[model samples]
Each structure stands twice: as C-alpha cells, then as structure tokens.
Target: MKKKDNVDLLLIEEMREEEPSWTDYDMDETSVKVQLTDTVFDMLLNDTISSLRRIETRLT
Candidate 1:
C-alpha cells in the first residue's frame, strides 16, 4: 500500500478509538458539529488531492 493509504488507515483507527469520548455528556452539540465539519473538510481536501493525482497520472 501507499504511504498515504497507510497514514489514512492509521488516522481512521485512531479516530475510531477516540470517537466515544467526543460524545460524552459534557460535550456540547456545537463541539460535535465543529468536529464533523472538520472531518468533512479533511475528506474534501483528500479527495481534491486524489483527483489531482489521477489527472496528473493520466496526463503523464
């Protein structure tokens, strides 16, 4: 597997391990929303990078 895939897998594993804590009663909805937004943003960023890589590969 590629280094990027390995990194993403590690991130996913870590997120799964820590996900429960983010839902604790003391945490507010706004915090959860922010986290979700951040996750979406990261996903979009990765998608953009992957798309660019694909385009570059095709061009080459």
Candidate 2:
C-alpha cells in the first residue's frame, strides 16, 4: 500500500469552481458556448482520469 494526498479531493470538486455553474441562455449564445464548453469538459474528463489513477495506485 501507498500514501495518498487529500488535496486530490479538493481538485476533484467541480462545483467548488464557478465556471461550471449551470445557466439559462439564448440558443444562439448557447450554441457558441457549447463548443468551448465541450473542450473544457473533455479536458476535465482527462484530468479526472489521471487523478483517479493516482489515488487508485496509492491504494494498491
């Protein structure tokens, strides 16, 4: 077994940040925003996997 850092818990907190807050908007604005949002979401997913892997490795 290995040690883990608790700070990963904070980094895992999506709601703690303001950028991801849900909002109501016009479709035209939303359409443009969606592209940028998708890229951000993809990056988040990539980061989440790495964070999870680090924690998982620490448990083994």
Candidate 3:
C-alpha cells in the first residue's frame, strides 16, 4: 500500500480538539500523587503498550 503525503481533514480536526492550550496549568506534585491511583496507572500503561504494539505490527 502507498502512503499519502497529506494528513486527513478529520484527523486534523480531531487533533485540534485534543491539543492543549497555553492556559492549561501543570499539575502539582501533590495533586499528581493523589490522582495516580494504581488502577488508573495500570490502565494507562496497558493502553500505551497496546498502542505501541499496534504501531509496530503496522510497520512490520
């Protein structure tokens, strides 16, 4: 399959929605400590690992 040079319009719109603004403040260490529960951390790690595996499979 051939790759397209240009990005899809839908993807551009989705990214525009997901992009963080300058006004967004960084979380404090204490806030992060409070929020990073084991279940949330585990889910985040699993999602990231799954995403990487999908990308690797596509590349190969």
The best candidate by lDDT is: 1
- Worst 10-residue lDDT window, candidate 1: 22-31
* Model 2 stretches with alpha carbons more than 4 Å out: 1-30
Write the residue-wise lDDT of candidate 3 on 1-60 in tens digits: 123424466677778887775335566655777677766989999999999999999999
- Tally clashing residue pairs in candidate 2: 0
Off by over 4 Å in 3: 1-36
Tell me the spans in candidate 1 whose CA falls farther than 4 Å from its real position: 1-27
Model 1 per-residue lDDT tens digits across residues 1-60? 699999999999999999989877665877889999999999999999999999999999
Ranking under TM-score, best-scoring first?
Answer: 1, 2, 3
Best TM-score among the predictions, by candidate number: 1
C-alpha root-mean-square deviation, candidate 2: 26.0
**Which residue pairs in candidate 3 collide?**
none
lDDT of 2 at 36: 92
Question: What are the lDDT scores of the predictions, listed in order?
Answer: 0.94, 0.78, 0.75
lDDT by residue (1-60, candidate 2, tens digit) is 123455666566654574545554577698989999999999999999999999999999
Listed per model in order, the count of residue pairs whose N, CA or C atoms clash below 3 Å is 0, 0, 0
Which 10 consecutive residues of model 3 have the lowest summed lDDT?
1-10
